[model samples]
Target: MQASEVDYLIIGAGSAGSVLAGRLSEDPGTQVTLIEAGPADRSVLIHCPAGLALMAKSRQLNWGFETVPQPGLNGRRGYQPRGKVLGGSSSINAMIYMRGHRADYDAWAAEGNAGWSYEEVLPYFKRSEHNERGADAFHGTGGPLNVMDLRSPNPFGPRFVEAAKEAGFAANPDFNGAEQEGVGLYQVTHKNGERCSAAKAYLTPNLGRPNLQVRTGALVTRIVLEGRRAVGVELLEGGQTVTLRARREVLLCAGAFQSPQLLMLSGIGPADELRRHGIAVRHELPGVGAHLHDHPDVVLVYDLPGATDLFGLSLAGAARVWRGIGEWRRQRSGMLTTNFAEAGGFIKSDAAEPIPDLQLHFVIGKLVDHGRKTVFGHGFSCHVCVLRPRSRGSLRLASADPRAAPLIDPAFLQDPDDLRRMVLGFKQMRDILNRPALARFGGRELPASASARSDAEIETFIRNHADTIYHPVGTCRMGTGALDVVDTTLRVRGIEGLRVVDASVMPSVVGGNTNAPVIMIAEKAADLIRAQA
Candidate 1:
């Protein structure tokens, strides 16, 4: 059957897809269609900032993906939960608004990605943010997405900031501002204590537009290619197969994992791999699933010495929770409205470096294995992760069928340098916790014994406990290199009318949270597409 054609057919209403749809559809003459495999963003758990942990393991709103067994990780498979909802991972994430280091972006431009330098992309970051702090040279006030500080943070949040300072890190009020080399409370994508997911910021308000059509539960099977050009997509909707066409362009925004998977399924990947799977090759892009990277983090849980933690919720604590819920249901404030990863910072493992090499997240409660169950009483957890890992991995086709999940091999810690960096990162985390400022509030739960001091012990800890901090990128890297899947303009290397505008195109993983950067990429891509129009 013939299908309806739109000006822009956006596959995946994720962080980038939503923003692209909203921006491109602003001109009434352009028609945009955004397809998402998941359902709508109607879950209360998604909006409640404190409820992020509960949604982490929920398959209802997440694509509960696990990696192929890794030899370096003692043959253990790691859990990778990505958002399958309207806003994608942004809906279920901790909402930290970090842009990483300026050096990270400059490195991308240095690698032939011309317009991605820190100076060039900073305006896009500012243009997309409606910071509560008001308009400045570094922040935008009338943007779609809202960026604000936590309404009220955990008591330990302030203490963590002081601890970081005592450990020799400067107090940086904004990681996305003038500098990123410090420790302090993180700003989040929130407005008046509610989540400002891309769906909320871009899709929700624009739902009334006549030119925009958003279809949930549309699982794209493959791109509908007319020779080497992508014209649209074939998808499954309500147990029926449907083919949709795009008159102008077909943008893939399915993120780091699925974007490459979709490309491979559409015969736009390595020639040898496609032939191995008995699929015809339309383009021989060998880098479709190469250069996969993620930030792996290890959690150090410690028992608090007093009742100043969130775990100490007695009847008074229950009262506080209830009161906060009431306030959130009414005016949107209090504890219920904050993403509990209240404070965090970046630090250099080696002081001689120009930027930080490690990232930290300070939580006021104990969370073992994605907070499956709450521990009783007061406890704290500091997650230490290497900002830049030397190890690299890839995504590959398990089968030619698009319905089959792609094989993910993160190859974490395969490089000895990664292990060394993780050791230093953990040691730095220990230094912060041992500082006099934090020592007054908590004692060591995990002591730094001889095992903690040994290289073998640290390596074992990393292999056994390290999991994704939820930042994954570089599967379909953008550059002018021979192995690059996309060029600097986000257009596919060998295909026309096909662009990848998501985390998949990151030439290298940014040092901090990826949501803000992903949104900035979409904001930039929108302008590029408009210029083409």
Candidate 2:
């Protein structure tokens, strides 16, 4: 059958893809088609904030990608769960609305990529946000995506603030404000009591527009390239093969791991790797799958028998939650509105560093291995992740089949410096928990930090327990150098009519959560595409 044609064909109905489709289709003359490998974002587990804890275990909503055994992590494969639904990870994430540090974007521009400075990109960040606190110099008010404070946080949430002050960090209400060096409650991408996924904010609203089309369960197998230009995509839908052509551009927003995997499967990666997989080399882009990295995090879990505000598996805890459901239904305010990682802050492990090298996530649950492991009892956990790391890894083709999962290696903590910073971060979290503010909650560490008194012991603990914080980037990095996969405008190097607009294009991972920054990227890319047109 002849392929259906559109002005723009987008792969992956993720944060970026959803935003792109919405923005591009705003021009009634521009026809856009978006395809998602996963199903629609309709699960109740996806919309409810409290359901996120349970959603972490829903296989149908997660891509369930795992990393290769890291020699640095005692040969344990890290568990990675990217969202498989319409909103992508944003649909399943903690919804923390962080835009990263300002210096991060300045460094991106300083690295020879023009138009990415903090000043240049700030507008885009503001453009996509609809803050509940109203419009201001730092935030936008009427944008599609909602940003608001949790309707009701756990009672222990305030204790985290007091603990941070007791631990010597200044209290700042906004992490995205003038100064980022402080402790505070996180603002989440939630409105009322529901998750404000990218699909909910962008795609769903535009579904009624005549210029846009969305297809779920459309797994793109490869980019159908003609010589050096991408013309369309070959995909499998409902056991039937289909081809969809793009009249103007083909955008790959399949994210860090799969975006590069798609490029390689379409014969656009390292020549040697492509040849080994028995695929014809269309273009040899050596940097297609290089520099894969993520924030390596360790959690300090503590038993909280005295706490009733936290979610737990105990009978009393269940009863409290049952009451919370009624409260939520009646007023849309209660413990059910909790994002779990409700209170967190940024801090510098080393005073000499220009910005905070460590980021914290205070969870009101015993989160273990992405919440896949069940630990009995009531508890609270604090997660500390190195904001940036020197270690680098890669993505490679495990099989030529597009349906096969790619071999992902994040090479977590391969650098000794990364391990050292993590040690400091771990100590910092322990210090806060030991403070009088949190001590009143009556809890003890799970792994017993009493044994981890020295650097060697802490390193051993990290190697045995560290895992991904789920922010992966740089596999299809954008820059003007040969080592970069895309240019400043996100166009793939040595290719025409093709661009990657997702976390994969980030030259380096941002300092905090990635969802907000991804939306900003698509907002900026839309203007770039329009200007060129």
Best candidate (score: lDDT): 2
Model 1 scores a C-alpha lDDT of 0.87
Q: What is the C-alpha lDDT of each candidate?
A: 0.87, 0.91
lDDT of 2 by residue, 1-533 (tens): 12399999999999999999999999999999999999999897888788888776788989888899899999999988898999999999999999999999999999998999999999998999999998888899889999999888787778988998999989989999788878889999998788999999999888999889899998999999999999999999999999999999999999999999999999999999999999999999999999999999998888888466777788888899899888877887888888999898999898998899999999988887778888778888999999988899999999999989999999999998899999999999889988999888788888655578798998898898899999999999999888799999999999999999999888888899999999999999999988888
Which run of 10 residues does model 2 get worst, by summed lDDT? 444-453
Q: Give the TM-scores of the predictions, in the order they appear.
A: 0.96, 0.98
Query: Which consecutive 10 residues in model 1 have the weakest lDDT in total?
Result: 442-451
**Which stretches in model 1 have alpha-carbon errors above 4 Å?**
1-3, 305-308, 311-319, 446-451
Clashes in predicted model 1: 0
Structure candidate 2, residue pairs in collision: none
